[model samples]
Target: MERKHELNNKKVLVVGLAKSGFAAAKVLVKYGANVIVNDMKELEKNQEAKELINQGVEVHCGSHPLSLLDKPIDFIVKNPGIPYTNPLIDAALEKEIPVFTEVELVSYLTDAEIIGITGSNGKTTTTTLVGLMMENNPKKPIVAGNIGTVLCEVADQTDVDDILVAELSSFQLMGVQSFKPHIGVLLNIFDAHLDYHGTREAYGKAKARLFMNQTEEDFCIFNADDQEVIALVENMKSKKVPFSTKQTLPKGACLNEGFVTFNDERIIAIDEIVLPGEHSLENILAATAAAKIAGADTNQIINVLKTFSGVEHRLQYVDTVEGVKFYNDSKATNILATQKAISAFNQPLILLAGGLDRGNDFDDLIPYLINTKALITFGETAPKLIKTAKEAGIKVIEHVDNVEKAVPVAYECSVSGDVVLLSPACASWDQYPSFEQRGDMFIEAVHKLR
Candidate 1:
């Protein structure tokens, strides 16, 4: 890429050895940087480390020794998940060395305009919609970042005419220094990842980084209804485009007379949209704003909104067993997300909820549990959720061992017309390694009932 000169002969330490780290290390090596990789996993368990070692890069596994900082290191490329509170990271900061996530490398690797999407919820859905909307455009779309693919890898192969549609996490955005998106979309912000961020303010600041480097020429698509989003974008340099479901906006994407409109031009009738929920409507408006700004026509936007159901694990509809429809919303890793999922359906819900206890209560979720027929709780937060269920007057609350166990319990409590929803209002780290695994287990258990 374009910024290879900045990395050539520089000593770059790549912390953490996951997909992002591996991709970062390889890119650093390709740019002629002296790369040193570190991870907590043992060397034998880290196949990526071994492969990198063969590429003339230094590999350090099993520990992040403070001594790694003793050398004259130029900078660090850290995995997004590794918090700044990490001892090595803290030490590096004290020494005035720059630290970054692999996301920072995206700006250096490609000239393609990037459309970055971030929020506490609905990020994946909006990013997916924008990617689909841009499919027929003259500029190709390379979807990457937190949606799974390493962004730098996609950036390396991207041409100047391409567009990078990325679903970014707050963690990934926090490490970016000069990264800027041509079109930045913030769906909504909520209390999330407090354990890593230490406070809601820090989390919002990280999400705001998506537009930090954008100029007045760029566009920032944000939620007009969310006060937190409005407050955060109050002083951004980019041209602000607000989308809302609560009120009609005169100049941005909004609902006008039961239709989705951008700048007062109708795109599609809301009733014809395939995705369910008011939250999905918010995503559609945000995506519509970004897609239209990036040269997508009304027909291109309507095509995806009509056919796209949703990304997997975010209110994804699973198979129907015995007339009981199941939905996998395991990606609902916070109170607001689960609240939105619960509000999506009028069908009596056999809600499956619980996961990592992030020092938050479910009291806020009580108001939305009015129609829930039963609550199946699991993971570290089971007791807390059970308490919330009882307070909500949910009489049929059952505490199960895990998601798979909860599936059968949910089905057992359900009759023909009830909806079984696996929308845990917490992170999946307490039992399953990821939310996708938990969702897969729930899907497998639902299949077993057949």
Candidate 2:
């Protein structure tokens, strides 16, 4: 846990007052860095800003003032979700000042080997599973990044004997410079955050950065089933390890004769796995590949796969109310993610979807809707989703204002053999602060059903 770089008396600007930003500022201060925490919210509303001030770190609230940059700044640790279009970020770049994501900052501060996971979907689940599998490792793996804890918050607590299992996102990977992972996992790439990256190609480039700094000595674990993911690494330099749900790979993880095989070794049976869906299968394969390479034992992999149901909010079963099964997949914040979640079952389905529009085209999901018994829509994208459902020739459709209404109504439209699934193909910001909150509401609503 020794500091790799001296930060004593260095000027560091921690941008955005979110968890990652605040964590980075606290770490910087502990290192004797002169830290300035900037946030757009008013100080009275920003508890994080007040906390940083209490730690002797300077605070700049309300807006990123031009004067904040007037002072000489050393480096910037940015919140992953903060856009480059922010004037403060643009000004920092205009000044040629380097901006770093919390993970990037942690990479320099700790020697603990990183197992970085990234993709449009499944990163959170795969990251959690990998952490669980690696728990039996001597390194004592710690899960961080987009899953919950910012790496900066826990980096100094880890030693060379520890492993940092990070759930990375396109946003986090976009700003990375020298952030290399000893084990890099690319789950699967799809058209996501187009409003942020402006194009699918640009978004793919951001996720591809997860492998940018890896070398021949490092392992790049990727999804071979995803054409985009495979195409994204056509010229990659790292040691390649591909996981697949379809075709069996000669050297990586794959589904071989109903067994989850790792390099031709049968590890676990597909049916015995509690976590359902082909997408979950892919996530397990990816995590298994990464964990095995990271020195996890075969027995450890089998043990975790048989027990690790899933992370919260991704196709998590809520209950069976009146013979209607309820599932929370609120983490399906993109079109493809929702599609994958819904595709998990052959049972009659009452799908509840909608949220912040994000300008996502629902065209790709129409074919998946062909099997739905009913389509309930809500939030900002409700109308669009409803229209797409109708066009797909769905007979039963319901529209509501929010997920609170979508859940109960979806239940009403469901039969005994049907699943009431909340898989919003959009973000939760239109109704709740995060997808977790949205999924929690669905779980709460389902619990209310008699």
Candidate 3:
């Protein structure tokens, strides 16, 4: 496949100076595209912007005027974080110039076999698992997009035979037009990113696009268990290979008689895989289905599944002191994900909760919180969570300041045979740089208490 946006001395506008933005800017410059990069902040003080300027890419920080788009430019490559509602993007759209995303930009640069995975939940795990499954299989895959590295960086080092297991988010998916993967996996859909998507249906449509452009010759994997994903696949024009953990699927992968069977050819007992909760098991099942369709052998896929120690901050066991286990599930940014973390354990818990509220429905989490000893809440959404839990007849203690205050209280409350879980059913933008940072700070606080 020929590379898209060959650059080759064309003018390009790269918006937003995030990890993806910087990576995109570097590539645009390298390909001889006259790059004018912009961010909402000034470049002189911004580390990433300063680095890009040092590399000689034209920098426009603080703000990008609409008049800049009035001039002739080949195209605009947008960062996923910047919404389509932005005036700059609207102007570019009105001009009839092509607007692409970092994912689209990188997809065009490489001839590598791409595996695009998207969903409201379980996407990161699916992305990493697929990469690990292929690591020893001579593919030597690169996991990029929303997971580890940015797409531009991955594209810089990629070749055709090499696969890119990209964990694409809704933000990345929205601007995609010509981006089609060799294998596209939609794990499961739930209410997430509602603030950006504005509606559940809109978010689902973004996820569905993963397979929208896929041809009959390409592999599109669906989760039969998730009705949203299944319904979308049913209506999709693309040929789909489906997977289900709950029951047998006639076409792709299924669970039958206590064994996971893929294409009715290979079977593995659920006990053979070491992933912790039912959610992880489902993730593995989805990944196995996609991997098998991608020409990976069952035994090799099963071997990797048994060895993979789930992703960090997704039900990661932090430490245990005095019989009280500490589990860091800070990646639980929605009520559904939080409930999964809570349900995985039967023991009484002291849940350290709260973060940036994303219009979460707290009712689903009430039953689990009622089972918990008491709730220790913190951050931006703490007050709302406190009210919701109390309204539902669950005892919750609100500590609406920071993780520093919440951790020790949770530690003090936890006793023998209890688990302390930091599963904030909200975004981490309130107090940390990322979810990993939130989880790390919680771990550090636990150590101090210990």
lDDT of 3 by residue, 239-293 (tens): 6888887777766887777777887865578777777777777787778877776
State TM-scores per candidate. 0.98, 0.96, 0.95
What C-alpha lDDT, on a 0 to 100 scale, does residue 380 get in candidate 2?
Answer: 90
lDDT of 2 by residue, 1-450 (tens): 355457888888888878888888888888788888889899998998888878777888887886788899988888888899888889899999998888777765888898999988888899999998997778899998899788778887888899999988889888888888999999887778888898899999999999998888999988888889889887889999998888978989999999999989899999889888877888899999999999998888888888877779998988998799999999998888888998898998899999897765688899898679889998898889888988898899998878888888887787787899999889999889999999999999999896
Query: What local distance difference test score does each model get?
Result: 0.92, 0.87, 0.81
The TM-score of predicted model 2 comes to 0.96
User: Predictions ranked by lDDT, top down?
Assistant: 1, 2, 3
By summed lDDT, the worst window of 10 consecutive residues in model 3 runs over: 391-400
Clashes of each: 0, 0, 0
lDDT for 404 in candidate 1 is: 90
Residue 282: error of model 3 in Å? 1.8
What tens-digit string does per-residue lDDT give for candidate 1 at 14-113? 9997999999999989988999899999999899999988887899999999999988998899999999999999999999999999999887788898
Error of 1 at 311 (Å): 0.7
Residue pairs with backbone atoms closer than 3 Å in model 1 (clashes): none
